[model samples]
Target: MLKHDYKVRTGNNQYEGFLVDLIKEVANMLNFQYDIYLVHDGKFGSKKADGNWNGMIGELISGNATLALGLLSITSQREEAVDFTKPFMIRYITVLMKVTKSTTSYFEFLNPLHPFVWFCTIGALLFVIIVLYVLERIGNINRTDYPSISFKECFWFVFGSLLHGSTDASPSTLSGRILTASWWFFALILILSYTANLTAFLSVKTINTPIKTVTDLASQTRIKYGTVKSSGTSGFLKNTDIEHFAKMWAQMSEIEPSSMVDTSEVGFKKVKEGNYAFIWDTTVNKYKTIEDCDLMEIGPPFDPQGLGISVPTGATYTEEFSMAILKLNDTGRISEMERKWWVHRNCPDYSNPSTDKTSGLQIENVAGVFFILVGGVAIAAVLCLGDYIAKRILKSVKKEKVHAISPEGDDI
Candidate 1:
């Protein structure tokens, strides 16, 4: 229904090739005819008289394109100028503090109690608690009163659903038995598959390679870390600080090659220098400077964050594109793309990740939670059973006492 013309802007030329490939893929998938407009010098589009901010805004105000995609951040100015698609990739930002900063700086990033860490830890804990709760309820149910059980039994139901077992907890009910038997085949298949995958991924008999931390870089007799120029990284700014310069002046320290290199040259020089680290994203690799450097993220994104696409403000397509992304997410295709692009190569190997490990893990994690709930219910049922047995024994003894009392009364 529409003609596609890409209006792109970027500071780096190395990304041109990757962008071309990406555009081709988009073109193949898009039903509309499209043309590529590469503005090599960080220019917005042809609307820009000189590729400046005023021109870019004027283009959007004038309705130049249907959608604009770039390495742009969703800042207030941009938000005012255009509508953004939900960010597909979350990017983390981090401080480039020297390993020595742990001792020198007041910030306590190492503590596990840090707020971000707490969020992740607490989330995992809650998931476990919820699962255990459901499991406990499911395990305690009797067939006769299955319908009257608490709503928490839904957790048990989901567990049963995943396991391909009957959702009913009533052991004596024929309906429950039939449902259980019907689900068994599916339940066993999911369980065995997950178990095998988990075993394969988690098994590690030897620590052949020593794990390295960001701190280790500073201890080395030679230490150099590379970051993109003008990046938000605070450590890069600190590297140029007067205090560091003063230290060099006082110590009569030898000049490090990294200390001499510029931002453009940092990626090229750091890898050749032993004990040096490069900090750049796989996204930046769309540019050429990182082609030679053996780059590793100093660690998993010191801060995870995201980038997004934008449409001109008030464009009707905004909601349509937003809905499309959501639909992709609901269908699990978004996660599939994420694994294919981000996780598969970048993250440690997950179970069967090469094909569809993300969906599998998500399914397992979900199932694990349900099973935990079932286990909780099972424990509760055992306690209930013990109480039932005790009550029966007590009643029998009471009857004997009553009979003895009646005989004594008759004799009297």
Candidate 2:
């Protein structure tokens, strides 16, 4: 709309916006009182195929209104019908889109870790399983009467360690024992990391980039786009020779249930319902989005044109009104009025917001698990060293006793 509800019927026909305020200033400057009325058709203007103009332009040409205001766009076609004051505001056409909540997938179990992460985990498991199997076979060769564990047995043993925290039987060789210990520590950390992230990791995902421009909309079929009917936005799209925009216009014309809407509010409603994009004036789109965190405008606005006051051609006050607008711009009164009308932001920017709480798990959340694992591994390594030392000392004592004995009967 020219304002969200650009012209509101507040208090039996009172209207507001910076536009309303601006006109008041103009009225005061020119020392002329004015009464504002809505164009009965409620359109800015569009030229019909028969060359008849409608909306505010008709009001101006037919002398039904002395001065037409509020979102009356200055166009070449409209210029021929009514004289336009200097453009007080610039309206850019842009896309308004609603972000849909992501649906949980059926294969959400794999969502906890990315695919690359899962692949690496499997790779690590296979590597450890193969190493354990090969080491056991080599040990069997060294001790000729022993039998090595099978590949299947090695896999189940390693997998059991990952799931249940440990295997009942471990390899006999020292190298294989060390590998098993390392795998156990890894399993502990991985389990902790996965559990810590399980709930948070499965939330939302962005499947595609947001449609920020007309070309982005044109390139995709998933989201339907449209603008208000018979407004400058539609006229621009319909009249332009640009390929992508032309495609968009063609779709709007031919699409079922009709993409064109009666009002900006309807366009915005479709966007909210889902898979719809509303292309309209940036200012109105921005106004809607500013107060509702769920709604948003995405752009570098296109097809920027001026919103100007309209009067019949050869009107005496046209120059006076343009100069008044220039005065307001120079004095920054227009800006002041704009801020006053849009009001303060009622909703925070969802895309980039300031918050007191962190939303999801980070490495910091699982770092303590890794620390516990490292400590456990270090203690195990030290205990293994102590055990090896104790074995060697016992072996040395037995050898000395055997060497000192005379005829194996008396102690030395």
Candidate 3:
């Protein structure tokens, strides 16, 4: 591929790969001598704002190379500049990111219910308490067995019922008991729902990632993502009018120093360091991630395209080269070459299938609740001290008033 640096040295120090072999075969059939070399800047050309090309496409347009090969994506923009042979390989752009470890945070308990849901649950509890107090007061107006209940008693009654705890207060009137029963039924359902969701959320170790798709990458600011500069992937991103891709291009272009990298190596290096993602050809990403265990492909590919050899706008070799590539494909030589270079390499099988496993709850999962408990105790201690100090001051004032009122300092 254009991104892969697949090479083998000949006795004369000549390099070889699928493209190299294809070229050699084509030359032999045509009986023409040819020279092979890398593009001047080692890039797949992209059209600059100045209306000129860079990379291998540039070399072809400028008549420096009779044929340009190696993962040269056949795009309409490039076709306008140069003629392309029939596509020899198909590929798509995909995201290559580092595999992040699943994490359980101290606030994992809160993950079950959204903040809005939690707030609404609290509001419902308060509403039930208010309704119960009003109903009980109205029903017990003339009943002496059930004394008037204060706001504090009502709060404790509702709170205890919700927690499946018993309270001393019992409604004597039929209407009061009915309201209490209705509340208990509601509380049971609420409790069951919360428990089920919380259990699921806590049982699974969530993979914390803001990016799962191209839209996710575009919408989030935390991860700085880009593709190789002056490559087909970059060009596709910059030129696409699709909302997410357009937004991503704008952000990449606006940022100083540019998010785009010169090579896939640098792009992937940024990913391993965290808070970055590399977008490039899926084939190259597949090969790289298989080689490096730390790397991973995030999602499916985008902007499906094919790679072809490039020739000058009016080049005479286009038809012959196209035919040669078709012959190689028909004979299955290309498939054999790809298998030899990509699949049979000395990397471990990172593509091995995995099964999901559940892990036991860790201390971190419930640490937030423990911290809240400690904080409540500390706050209660401060309030208790303040209450004691106020009592002592009030006692002292009363003693002074008693002494002033008595003929002499007598016991009051």
Candidate 4:
């Protein structure tokens, strides 16, 4: 339904225009047709092709296309020009500076209570509150639906579940039953898993690092913290402070004002040059480089947070995309994409990182069995409940029929 041009860097340094391929895939899935134009690779090209939104503004303003795709940083200023989707990738602006001083490490500054972690925590809490309030409202309106549960009760119910609660909401309504049995159960598990992982990330201590926090930058004896001039300098690397670098590397793959110098030899050239700090993203595997620079991540990796495709503000498309994304999450498409393009770069050697974390219980092995047991129990419950209601209705109907047919067969 729309014509668009797009480009991304290939494994080689050369730019590969793949607009047609993306169009084919998305169009087939969306059941629509569109014209795709091959745009220049933004990573290595003219200034216009750079990640900056200004250069591409001309195309959008001139009616060249309806939308532009790629790593277009969507900010409040640029948001006026074109709408952006939620971030498809999460990265942190980091300083690939040398560790000049041995005394100070970057780990001290990154605490668990940092704004990023708090934001996620608060967000989870708010979501729990909103869901509980909504459930409470529905429960209040219908007596047969969760009759005994109040808003406060439901709030604590979700709270306990998020922290560590047994699966007991005391919900009495069919709606509540269906909701918990379907959506909430899976949602809770995912949220908890990510939360746990994040907690572990924050707690990790770097064995040897001098600087700890952003404030300690001035005090950092020998290291110099810097980022790409385009992206914010201090703010990007502030959270990464030495300790969290590895965790950041594990979760993110792309970054703005990326330090990825060149795809050839994995940007090792810049690192080889001394005193020059390259602001690049950390990947799962280290690229062996012949460049003069050694790849030293100054601190923990931080979340740079970039533009993703989302519906316009106040548009239902946003919700639709979010719902679809959730479904994709259920199907593992989102994770698979990350593993393919971002993590492994489509390498077969790259295994599912999440699967490596499983301990006592393997979800894949037990999930089907668990579902079967649950399905049997649910079917049995439904049958028993249906039979009881059916018998009650049948008995009432028979009584009315008998009364109507009494004696002379006159209508009652």
Q: What's the number of clashes in each of the models? A: 23, 0, 0, 30
Across residues 190-248, which tens digit of lDDT does each residue of candidate 4 receive? 56666675454433322333443333443432433333333322224443455544333
* TM-score of every candidate relative to the true structure: 0.35, 0.67, 0.57, 0.35
- The TM-score, computed over Cα atoms with residue i paired to residue i, of candidate 4 is 0.35
For residue 194, model 1's alpha carbon misses the true position, in angstroms, by 46
- Model 1 lDDT on a 0 to 1 scale: 0.45
Minimal lDDT window, size 10, model 1? 97-106
* Residue 47, model 1: Cα distance from true site in angstroms: 18
Q: Which tens-of-lDDT digit does each residue in 91-161 have in candidate 2?
A: 88878878544344434545668889899999999999999999988877867555677888889899999
Model 1 per-residue lDDT at 82: 65
Best by TM-score: 2
TM-score of 1: 0.35
Overall lDDT per candidate, in order of appearance? 0.45, 0.77, 0.79, 0.45
Cα TM-score of candidate 3: 0.57
Which regions of candidate 4 deviate over 4 angstroms? Answer: 1-25, 32-53, 97-225, 232-269, 280-298, 303-306, 310-326, 342-412
Colliding pairs, model 3: none
The per-residue C-alpha lDDT of model 2 at residue 408 equals: 57
RMSD of each: 24.7, 11.5, 9.0, 27.4
State the displacement of the C-alpha of residue 376, model 3, in Å, after optimal TM-score superposition. 29
In candidate 2, stretches whose alpha carbon ends up further than 4 angstroms from where it belongs are 1-13, 102-110, 114-160, 163-168, 173-209, 255-257, 343-412
